[model samples]
Target: MAHAYVTFRIRLARHALADFIASFKSSGEIVVLVFGQVLIGLFALIAMPPMAASALPFYQSIPLLLAHGMAMSLPLFLLRRRVLPRDVVLAMHPLPIPPRIALAADALVAGILAGPLALAYIVSAAIWMSQGPEWLQADRALPATVFSFLVTCGCSSAILHLRARGPRPGPRLRRLTTLALGEPWRGPRIAYLWHRLFWLPFWRGDNVIGHQQSALLLGAIASAVAWTMAPAGIMGGVLDLTASASLILLADRGDKAVREQLGVLRPIMAAWPLQRRALEMCARAFSLAPVALLLALLFGAGLWQHTAGHVYLTLAMLAPVLLVAIPRFNPRARVGLVVASIVILTAVGSEIWN
Candidate 1:
C-alpha cells in the first residue's frame, strides 16, 4: 500500500513537471530567460570557491558562501509548490501513507525540481576539486552540498505538508481587503465593486494573498539589499535587474489570474459595460500602485546606481499595463516580448548609459 502511494505521488509530480516544462517551452522568450538564468547561476557557482578564498576577507566571504549555497538550493525551494500542485496535495492528504514514505516522495520530487542545479553543482565541485584550494577544501564541499540538499528538500516538504493542512485564510483576508477598500460607506457602489474585483486574485487562492504579497516582499527585500550594499556596484546592478525581472514575473502571474477571473465573468461584464470599464480602470490602478510605490522606495533610498536605472525601472513599471494593453499576441508570447524588452533595456542601461 505504501509503495503504491509513493508511486502515485511520483507519477503525479512527473505530470506536473511535464506541464511546467511545456509552459516554459511554449514561449521562446521564457526559454531564453530560463537558460540565461541557469548559465548565470552556473558561472557564479563556478566562481564561488576562488571568490570566497581570495576575493573577500574571511568574515565577508562567509555571507558570500551562504548566499551561493542558497542560490543553488533556491530552485527546489521556489518550485516546490509547482512540482506538488495543490490538487495532488489535496488528494494525498487523506491517505494513510507513512510519514517516512511521504517524506521520501517529497525529497524525490524536490530532487527532480532541482536536477539542473544539481548538475551545475557537480560541475562546480569537479572544477573546485581540480584546483584543490586550501581555503575551500574539496573534502568539506561534498558534505556541505549534501547538507544543503537535505535541508532544502526537507524544508520544502515540510512547507508543503503545513500548507496542505493549514487553515484557509481566504475569508478573513477578504474581509480585511473589503475594509481596506472602503467598501460600503466610502466609495460608490460600482467603483467599489470593480475595485474589489481587482483584488479578488490575491485572496481567492488557497495561499491567501500569496501572489501579490510575494511581489511586494521581493520589492522590499531588493530595495533593502541594494540599500545595504550601498554605492550601487556590480552586485547592485545585478540585484536591480534581478528584482525587476522577479517583479515582472509576479505581475505577469497576477495579471493572468485577474484576466482569468474576468473571463469567467464575461456575461455579467457584457451586461454592464460600465462595470467592465470600471473593473479595467480599477485593475490598472491597483496593479500599478505597488510598482509606483516600489519605484518611489528605490528612488528615495538612492538605490539606483545611475539615472539610467530609472529607465529600465520605468519599462518594468509599464510591463503589466503593456501586457494587458497589447492583445494581438497570446499571453505567453506577450510575456516573452515584455521580459525580453526589459532585459534589453537593462542591458543597455548597464552597458551604455552608465
Candidate 2:
C-alpha cells in the first residue's frame, strides 16, 4: 500500500507539473507572469534604500518584511488560476490516491513554483537590513523572517483555494448590502434620499448602482478615515486610499456597463461570439482605467514631493497591465504595434516628464 501510494503521489505531482507548464502555452501568459516577477523584483529593490535609511532594528524589519512579502504574494494570489495547478487536482479526484496525498503533492508543486519569488523577498529583506543600524538582537531577525514567510505561504494557499471556487453572486450581493448600510442613516427615508441624491449620479443608466462600486467606495472612505486617524504612515495610508478608491470607481463603471449589456441582451445574443468579445473589451478597458489613474496620481505625488523614485515605481507598476492588455489584440501584427506604442510612451514619460 505504501509503495502504491508513493507511485500515485508521483503521478499526481507530474500531472500538476504538466498543468503548470500548459498555462504558459500562450506567449501572453508567459509575458504576464514574467512581467509580474520583474515588477516584484523592482519593488523590492526600490524599497530597500528607504527601508535601510529608516535604521530599523533587525527585529523590527520582520514586520516590514512580512508586509512586503504579503504584498508581493497578492498579485500571484489574484492570478492564481493562471499560475496554479488547479486542473491537475480536479482531474485526479476520482483516482485511487488518497485525498491527503493528492493535496500534499499539490502543495509541493505550488511551493516549488513560488519558492524563487519568496527567496527573492528574503534576500531583499536581508540586504536592506544589513545596511541599517546594528541590532541589539540579530538572531531574532532570522526567526521573524521564517515566521513571516510561513504566514505568507499560508495566506497564499488560502487565497488560491478561495479563488478556485470562482466568482459567485452571493458575496457580491452581501457586499452591496453592506455598502448601502454605510449611508448616514438606516431609516427608509434617509436610504431613499441617499440613493436618489448621492448614488444616482454614480448609478448606471439602468437605474441601479453596482454593488462592487458601492463596496469599493465604502472601503475607500473607511481607509481614508483610518489613515487620517493614524499617527504615523499617513502618507502611505492616504496614497493607498486614493489609489483604491480610484480603481474602485473605474471598475464600478466598467462592470456596470458590461453587466447591462450581458444580462439584458445575453439571451438574444446567446449564439453570438460578439457578446463574449464585448465583455472582454469592457473588462480590459475597466482594468486599464485604474492603472492609468494610479500612474497619474503617483506622478502628481512625485511632482509635488520631487521624488523620482516614486515616478519610476509607478512606471514599473504598469508592466503587468501592459502584459494583460497585449492579449486583447486580435491580430498578431497589432501586438507589435501596441508593444511599440507602450515602449515609446513609457520611455518618453518616465525619462522626459519625470
Candidate 3:
C-alpha cells in the first residue's frame, strides 16, 4: 500500500534526526545547536510573509518560471538523498496492489529520496502545482511537476538497478582520505572534506558533472543579481533554474560521494589511538573553505546593504557548523542538514532586512 512508502519515509526521517542529535556528542552542544536551528527556522517562518511579498513581483512577472523552478528543484532529492537496496525494492514491488497505483507511488518515493524535508518539499510542490493556474496553458505547474518527478524516478530506478549489479564506493573514498597528525587546520573542516571529496572530479578535470556544478553556481549568482536589480523583470526563469541547479549540485555531490565511497561498508571511520594533530586538515581546508564561504555569502548577498554585520555573522555561523558538526554525520545526512541549515539561515536573513 501507499502507506508502506509513507512508513518508510517516516523511518528514514527519524533515523536522520537521531543521527543529527548524535552528531553533537555533548548534551549541551546538542541542545544549543538544536535550539539555534529552531530559532533560525522560527525566524524564517516569521519572515516568510515579507519574503513572499518581496518575491511576489518576480513570481507574478513570470509564473511559468516559478512553476519550472519549483518543479526542477525536486530532483535534488534524488541526488543521494536516499539509496534503497535492490532487494528491498524488489520485495516492495509487489505491494503496489494494482500496478498503476504502484507506479504513482514509486514516482513519488522514487527510492533515493531519503530526506524528510525534501519529501515534504516535493509533496508540497505537487499540491501547489495541481492547484496552480497556468496562463500559458492550463495548470502548467501540475504537468511540469509530474514530469520532473518522473525524470527523477527514472534516475532513481536506474540507480536501483545499477546498485543491484555493483557495490558501494564508501571504502574507496576512505582510502582516498588523507588523514594526518598535527597538520595545519584552518577554515571549516566540513568544507574541507566537502571540497576534498565533492570537488575531486572537478579537480581531476572531469568535465560533465563538474561543468554542471559550475554552470549551476553561475546561474544561481546571476539569478540573485537579476532579482536584486530587477525583480519584476524576466529573472524569474533564472531564479527557477538557479533554485533547481543549486540544490541539484548538493544532491549530485551526495550522489557522487555514495558512488565513490561505498557509504555502507564502513559505519564509523576508525580513529587512530592518538588524536592526529590535524596538520593535514588545516593545510587542506583552504581548497573548499573559500568555496563554502562563497556559497554562504550568496544567501545574504543582497542584504549586505542593510545588514552587513548580520550577513557576516550568518556566514560565520556556517563555517564551524560545517567544519566540526557536519563531518561527523553520514554523507547523506550531512548533505541534508547543510541544505536545511542554509534554507533556514536564508529565511532568517530575509527577515533581518525587513
User: What TM-score against the true fold does each predicted structure earn?
Assistant: 0.69, 0.41, 0.33
Clashing pairs in 1: none
The deviation in Å at residue 262 for candidate 1 is 2.4
Between candidates 1 and 2, the TM-score winner:
1
209-298: candidate 3 lDDT, tens digit per residue: 455446555665565455444453234433433432343344334334333342421333334232222522432343343345445555
Better of 1 and 3 by TM-score: 1
Write one digit per residue (lDDT tens) for candidate 2, span 244-291: 333433443444344444455557556754545545554445544444
C-alpha RMSD by candidate, in order: 5.7, 11.5, 12.4
Better of 2 and 3 by lDDT: 2
Which stretches in model 3 have alpha-carbon errors above 4 Å?
1-155, 167-275, 278-284, 292-354
Give the number of the best model, judged by TM-score: 1
lDDT of 1 at 266: 72
Candidate 1 per-residue lDDT over residues 1-354, each given as its tens digit:
558766776787788678767655534465366447766665547645433443456576555555555655555545556656666667766878787776777666666666665676677767776776666655445655655555555655665566445335577767876776665557676656654555554555444345545655576557545643544467656655665555555556555555656677777678764756666656645655555666666556553665665565567566666765654467567766666765765564454233
CA lDDT of each candidate?
Answer: 0.59, 0.48, 0.43
Summed over model 3, clashes come to: 20
Whose lDDT is greatest here?
A: 1
Candidates 2 and 3 compared: the better one by TM-score is 2
Name the regions of candidate 2 deviating beyond 4 angstroms: 1-66, 83-106, 122-142, 161-335, 346-354
Model 2 local distance difference test score: 0.48
